[model samples]
Target: MKKITCPLRWILFLFCFPVVGSYVCAQDSVSVLFIGNSYTYVNDLPGTFGALAANLGKELTIDSKTNGGYTFQNHTTDPLTYSKIHSKPWDVVVIQGQSQEPSFPDVQVNTQTLPYAMQLSDSIWANNPCSNVMYYMTWGRQNGDSQWSEINTFEKMNTRLYHAYMRMADSSDRAMVSPVGRVWSYVRANYPLINLYNADESHPSLEGTYLAACTFYTSLFRESPSGSDYHPGIGAGEAWVLQNAAAAVILDSLDHFHLHPVDEPTQASFTLVQNGDTIQLTNTSSRATTYTWDFGDGQSAITEDAQHTFGGNGIYNVQLIASSSCNTDTFSIQVTTLGVHDHLFDGIKVKTSDEFIELTSSGGTFLIRTFSIDGKLLTEQSLSNKNPLMISRINQFQVLHLTDSGGFEKVIRIF
Candidate 1:
């Protein structure tokens, strides 16, 4: 045989490798922990998670701890240890040194601090097992202070911090960096006057905080902020701005790496009462390849056809899921107990003049019956092969009795 090789072989192998790998890494939910100082706690950054959850329709648990001016040195040097984080489980831990430490004149302080932060992260993972660590790369103060002259200006100071954080995070396979600083850097380029801090240019104002909140929401929740009357995009003036640069960094970093898991299957359907107590679900979508049924009354099925007999007077949520190779649709049918003469029947016009009652099946089968006050069935007729029955003269305080060909008795009381 000739020594010929196929070019398509390598491509097929590469494509199949990831698809097989994703199945092994799919997760139901993600848990995150935020560890920072006043920058994270000042206006309760973690508190905004609820709003993010409501907006994105995602359920995630976030725990955060903050100190006013604590640095990595303070964290590793006793007094304030990782005691609170020792016992619980976490999927990801976000850590940041004191906001100013990265740009400090003494490189020794930052050099010493990075190792301690990494050590603490390792200890956290050792205790919890399956956890990843991430660093929050913060920005410099807007004011160009004399102590940071080596950084030239506030912008340069923040830039150095961003690069340094990334280098530290990239060194270890277990750690990653949230580019909150890069987001700020991009924003500062467009709006030179837009400082996230207050008049001191060191702390954030309400507008600054809102902007920061948007970045965090987008980064963690994967939802973009819709410019409302209150919050406009970055194009609007500072007063109308809602999201800050730090948040944008985090959001962009997340987007750069597609981190969303594969969607789970869902099913939806409508339920119909074929007879008084027998309920049947009809698949609305034509594409449903498989059906899963969970009838609220302890009935379940994995077949396309699902049938249930409701025994008593109560409300039940009948859930049906229809799924295909591509997607799944879920629907819930609420079967409620109804008094014979429920108001829903008020809109139905009666076609008879005597004390007549009509029984209807969801499959369009209908029967009419006339009854005496003592439950005596005077006359009965098949009104329609399949439809709701039309009865007249059904006044207040009367009982409806229906007798099927199978000798099934359905009793409905008119109030």
Candidate 2:
């Protein structure tokens, strides 16, 4: 019994709902903050979501700042919303846009919805660089929009909402979309007896909220909630249907929702080759496209490879920072060039070629080993009586530890 033609119009109602309420309960816990309108505050969606998380043996510290009919644009301007974002480092922040705003024309959505969504997202990252930004992806109005001609049906409105949410999530940071409307579409087609609409053919009935809660559970945990014993006021059979639909729509298509395949952290490391007061830096970082180096003398450079000269050397702590779109890593080392010159080690002649190092021993069985500055044993070999020893590729400024058969030691500094 979808809406045919209602006599009334409903748009933009503002009522800031407040609720009264954390523990180290489960092995997995997440802190989520919901910012939306009645769609989120009605059934206490955050509370319901927390209950579902606890039911599944996971913990959720849920909170919300909901005012009826709040839009993403409104949140962008509201001081209260900014305060909430800066309150703490939320593990995840769920942004829900106004019901009809996203379903409007594409131009309207791009102008009104997407930009503000991006603003909010930027704020989220600025506050906590590691926080995950998620869009709630509300369902279409139960009946449809009576005022608009193009989206006069539930199917049409739902499609537009999908597109808008997807656009918001398609940014470089890659936010997650819960796809609640997508799951709602599945249920309305498959489970008719469950009235998702309360009375005005809009907003969510208890069943609708439960359905949303199930959808969110799957979206957040990436697991099906079909067998959870805490269905609350709904029958187990009905709840199972909702959970399965969520699993089918979201769980089955996780990549579509941008949920799976967590972001890989940036890798940062480097090696140095020092010649007098000048040193050459080779970037060994991985999973990073950009790099920044701190020469520790109030000087810095943004490049993959760098050569910096110290002003009459002491010890310099050189650092390299490697970064990607969503991740950052840094590595640093202490380097000195006080007395860097050609030195003889136990009368063993050393020759340096482009990629290899050759060592000649004057008729003695000594062990030759190359080690990194951090004392890691890079390579080791026993030098037989008088044969020339050839060492494969080695970084400049690397240290070589030499010991005679009598266990006497000499250290040769090479660059």
Candidate 3:
């Protein structure tokens, strides 16, 4: 089978995209500090998240400065919270507010919640300028909050929570949201059988905490959690579904969240077109002066656009390094070329590049679904030969399952 590699897209604004910030791309040992209240403490959300990270082969040093009913305002005045912020050069700090306060009226939140959020975010950046501050976008009550007349349903409450958290995340130049709440909305819609609420209908149950952990894992790593083997108390199948929901929401549309605001480094990207044994390269890098290409077969080039014929038909990792005086960025993809018989699959042509997966059917309308190597659903759509479907936010490995209109099914692995 042939492979279409879609490299991760690094955007400057989100808290963590595929290749943004030094902390996000670190090889291992990501320190995360969660500062919240019962929502965080319930079911040990931080610990759950840490375990998920470790299961995925990333060591996440976890700590929390939490107290019951503590809001962002409460943390602002609390000395322990400030101490935690200054204690170490943490890679990421996740701060959450009292669940109800943010969903309140904007007039009240702008004063009581928003400013305090900005103050706390400012403190994180001031302590460690490289520290990535992520807002813990909490979920809504299972039912709506009866105390608020405007938010009388789950949807209303969640909408309020979403807007309120976005308000907090938007106020800072160097802050972004983990978006656990948005992921919760996805679970509620896609997997209603999973109860994310405690008996009180507010705090997270063990399963709910797992869902939140899954969300944070995807946010921090910019990858899917479906590959992990640990699920704690949740069933393996259910855990897989939760992990899928996290990836679908967090990774599929990461740019919708504000992740970073310090000056962006140069952005690097490129595309590949292969025919027979020769591969053509297109340099799409922005704000860069010099370029370097590694063909993975030991042959390399320095031009912005070049072509190379491989020694034989095999798999090779193609890499590009785009650099400027102040900074540099790199992107790589696995390229598989044939020494003869140039063909573009007359049935369907599926390709991935620059954070997107594009599928175009030539012969007929087909049902197409893409998955991670671990079998987590990434994108699903129906496209006739005329209209191609292009999805944003693709992972490193994808498995495409296709079904033609005549009811013929085929599965192809993409490397």
Highest lDDT among the candidates is held by which one?
A: 2
lDDT of 2 by residue, 1-415 (tens): 1122322433323322352222233453577888887788776777777777788887767768776667888899999888888988887888988777888887777787889998998898788776778888887777679778767789988888887787777652458788999999999998888888867777888888988998888988889887877777778888889878889888667755667422432456675655446767877564467999999988999989898988875888899999987688788877765543323234576666434777887666778888876777888887754677888753443777677767765554454
Against the reference, the lDDT scores of all candidates come to: 0.54, 0.74, 0.74
lDDT of 3 by residue, 1-415 (tens): 1111111321121223211111222244677888887778767788788778877788667778877667798899999888888879887888998878888888888888899998998898778766777889987788777766776678898988887887676566525688888999989998898888877777788889999999998888778899788899889998999999999887766655643222332445676655457666777664457999999999999999888889987899999998875367788877765443233334666575544667777766878887886888877888777788986643654466666666655655443
Q: Name the weakest run of 10 consecutive residues (lDDT summed) in model 3.
A: 2-11
Query: After superposition, which runs of candidate 1 have C-alpha atoms over 4 Å from their true positions?
Result: 1-29, 78-81, 192-195, 221-415
Superposed by TM-score, candidate 3 places the C-alpha of residue 54 at a distance from the truth, in angstroms, of 0.6
Clash count for each candidate, listed in order shown = 17, 0, 5
lDDT of 1 by residue, 1-415 (tens): 1111212533343344321000111233666677776666544555554343444455556666665555666666643347646636766667778766666544564466667776767766666644656677776667544454556577777777865676556443325565556666676776667666665565555555556656655555455654423432234556344444444445544523222222321224442433345555555432347788887888799877676777776788778877766467677766655344333222222222123344545332224455665767755666334455655543322445554444444544332
TM-score of every candidate relative to the true structure: 0.48, 0.61, 0.59
Candidate 2 is scored at a TM of 0.61
- Give the runs in model 3 whose Cα sits over 4 Å from its true position: 1-28, 259-415
